[model samples]
Target: MKKDKPKYRQIIDAAVIVIAENGYHQAQVSKIAKQAGVADGTIYLYFKNKEDILISVFSEKMSVFVENLKVIIQESITAQEMLARMIEGHFKVLSEDHHLAVVTQLELRQSNKDLRLKINHILKEYLDLLDDILQRGIQAGEFIEDMDLRLVRQVIFGTVDEVSTTWVMKDQKYDLVEMAPRVHEILLKGIQTQ
Candidate 1:
């Protein structure tokens, strides 16, 4: 598979920077190829076009992202702790990569309807992990008994997402990762069973 080749990752990584700096519509295949240190035609070997590259970037990065969260979740004994670690990990990862933050928080969200649909499909893995955590929390009495799992998942995910987007939009003026504990505390209080 093309993904198995070194250039594939090189191209994908390059595409991230290029798209983040140029925006998807302006991110040319030649620019990506140059960033990847390959020929323009080589991009076609790994992707159909700019749109495919964007989707692949989300797919590849999100797969690894969800796996890392699963590991962090497993390390915690309670759902609350797991959620905290998940928040920390999410914020830490994005903060460490400003370009990725910009791309995920802004650039990716600007894609066309069809592309957004595909991006949402890739996002399901991350959302499902959040749902699983909410289920575990309710089961363990860490959360309310009558909670709506779907709505709570959205709230949790949406809160973190909006916070990160705000940080990106504000030019990451403060410590985004440092906000994790506060976010965790606020979210915990909201869902914790009395």
Candidate 2:
């Protein structure tokens, strides 16, 4: 319920920019508060500490991701079509937000193993969308009938995640969204009943 508040979202969005610019260690709660245009104590109302903010940021962002994918899935699109759209949607979301790209791809990964584990828990919702596509594709006879769903999910998610990370590492020098189609082709070749 706290997440429904406007300042909560404002704080999360500001956290992205601050964390991206300052890195996780150097990004302070006060900086986030300044960015959010709220008092420093206001953050504590929604989050426990800086760690909580980091976790919440990922949660909030990925929630948007899962919601978008749900809409795409509901359009009655085939699993193969959904796969392509998912890739495009993934790339487009990060491409449009460089700060978010940096924070997610660079900053978040540098967190301690325990923190990383927590982040992975938040990622399950997004990962389920990938799994849904694989299962649906298998059901529709688009993917290999004997496909290993778990392995396929990892491959798909890793490919998309790696491409985005690499793009961020390269300072986003190239167009990321454009690579969606090519990436989709490579993934389909591996998973589709070719």
Candidate 3:
């Protein structure tokens, strides 16, 4: 697959930075090419267009997220620990990559409806993993068994997503990763049987 090529990875990484700095609508293929150190036409070899590049950027980064969560799920840990680790992992990834945080939290939201729909489709895998974590918690009697699974999933995801977006909006002055534990506590309190 083209994804295995070194240049494909280069273009994806460069696209994140360019989209973060320039906004999705303003981030031209030429700028991405320049940032990737590839010719403008070279991008066409890998992507159908700028929209394809944008979608690919989300797809590639989100796979890292899904894979990380998958590893955490496989560990012999309590549901609480798994949830905590999930929060930490989510926050840590964004905290470590400011450009990616901006692209995902800010730039992606500004895309057209069709583009947002495509991004949402890519997000379903990540959301499903979150559901897996919540389901595990419920099965272990760590969370309430009577709650609506779908709504709970939205609440947890919205909390994490909003916190990251707020941090990005504030230019990331605060430590996001540090906030993970506190956020995890709040979420657990709402869903865990007290």
Candidate 4:
């Protein structure tokens, strides 16, 4: 598959920087190619068009988060500890990569309808990771037994997403990782059984 080629990963990483620097609409195939140190036509080998490149960037980056969450879910820890790790991991990844944070939080949101739909589809995999932790919490009598899975998922995702977006919007002047513990605590309070 084209994705296995080194250039494919290079283009994907370069695309993030290009798209993050120049919003998706303005990000050009040639710019991404230049950033990847490849010819413009080389991008076409891996992606259908500019839209494909943008969506692929999201898909590639989010896959890492999904895979990491999967591993976190399997760890032998309390549900609350797992949730804490998830928040910390999410913040750590974005905080360590300012370009990715800008692209995911700002550029992606400005895309057109169809692009947003595709991005949302990719996002579901990340959101679904929360269900395992939520269910575990309920089973352990930590979270409210009657918790609505969908709503709880939305709450967890929306909260974490908004926090990251806000940090990105603020020019990332503050430390995002430092806020993870508080975010975890706030979320736990809302979902945990009293």
Candidate 5:
């Protein structure tokens, strides 16, 4: 029996924890392998290099995130509600997974410019979800028609991202979910119907 190809996901999860705690610069393949309870050689089997592991982690987690968001938004009756749900969902996921949040918000940002660009590409799906809601809100007349979709999308995403980062930086003392309504309200101030 093929020794069930050591789940790459398990390695990735271990990488997230290791990277989150050690910071990207200090995290090594050997450390990740040790965290995952696997041999150092096992990592090379699943990834070409450390960078590949980082990118794979983001791609795998983010793709599922986008898919789940799409499904949730589809079930909602109104664009405004969908936007609120989206914001809440985004914060909920990050806040619940403290390791992933630290890796994404802090360690990932420490990556070199080229890797950052690659990560940005992986983030497009999530951004597209926001753009979809913004467009829908515009069509429904719930949001301002004059708004620049791209800029508004950035603002909305940036706002929630900042909130999450602050929560993480402050040792996550407060409940992150509770901030959802306030974040949604602040975002709406610039886009909501007059």
Candidate 6:
């Protein structure tokens, strides 16, 4: 029987799992196709190559993540509250999906310089969301006026990224969501108004 959803998405999802489990270097297209329960040729029909699949996965997942975060943050009345929720949402999503967490924190980073650059482009959407919050906070006097928005964005993203990576590397024994409050607190020190 034919599936209603597009075959490409299935293949990509399968690729996520395979890549997460086996690492990027070991995740052959054939393995991804098999995991998706489709033929090897089926993968090519959707993606140009293995790299295309990886890039597409990051782009698609990050796009959805940023879009959702934007809506949530818009509904928030305060920049601090919005920043808290964004961090919570990010850690929650990454923590809930082990495969995705592994793919994002570990496997995806194993790509060469070119692929890494492409992934960085995909990451801009999420980075922009953080930057928007920083800008708003600066304007509202909630955060310091002299704060470097770009550097602040990097610190926020990097801190959360490192925290999540450590959790994943530790086999995720602790609750990632519990760290959100502390993460927000530490970040606030640098940005908050005295």
| Model number with the top lDDT | 3
- TM per prediction: 0.98, 0.97, 0.98, 0.97, 0.95, 0.95
Better-scoring candidate (lDDT), 3 or 6: 3
lDDT of 3 by residue, 34-128 (tens): 99999999999999999999999999999989999999999948788888998899999999999999999999998999999999999999999
Residue 24 lDDT in candidate 1: 86
Arranged by TM-score with the best first, the candidates are: 3, 1, 4, 2, 6, 5
The TM-score that candidate 3 achieves is 0.98
Candidate 5 pairs with clashing backbones: none
Error of 5 at 95 (Å): 1.4
lDDT for every model? 0.91, 0.93, 0.94, 0.92, 0.88, 0.88
Candidate 5: list runs displaced more than 4 Å: 1-6
Off by over 4 Å in 6: 1-5
Each candidate: RMSD to true structure?
0.8, 1.0, 0.8, 0.9, 2.3, 2.4
Each model's total of backbone clashes: 0, 0, 0, 0, 0, 0
Per-residue alpha-carbon lDDT of model 1 for 1-194, expressed as tens digits?
88899999999899989998999889999999999999999899889988999999989888777998899778889999889989988998889888888899999989899999999999998999988888889899999989888888888999999999999999999999899999999998889988
On a 0 to 100 scale, what is the lDDT of residue 184 in model 3? 95
In terms of lDDT, model 1 sits at 0.91
Candidate 2 vs candidate 6: which has greater TM-score?
A: 2
lDDT of 3 at 174: 99
Expressed as tens digits, the lDDT of each residue in 1-194 for candidate 4 is 98899999999999999988988888999999999999999999899999999899999999989988989988848899989999999999999999999999999888899999999999988887789888889999988998889998988889999999999999999999999999999999988888
Better of 4 and 5 by TM-score: 4
Task: Name the better of 1 and 5 by lDDT.
Answer: 1
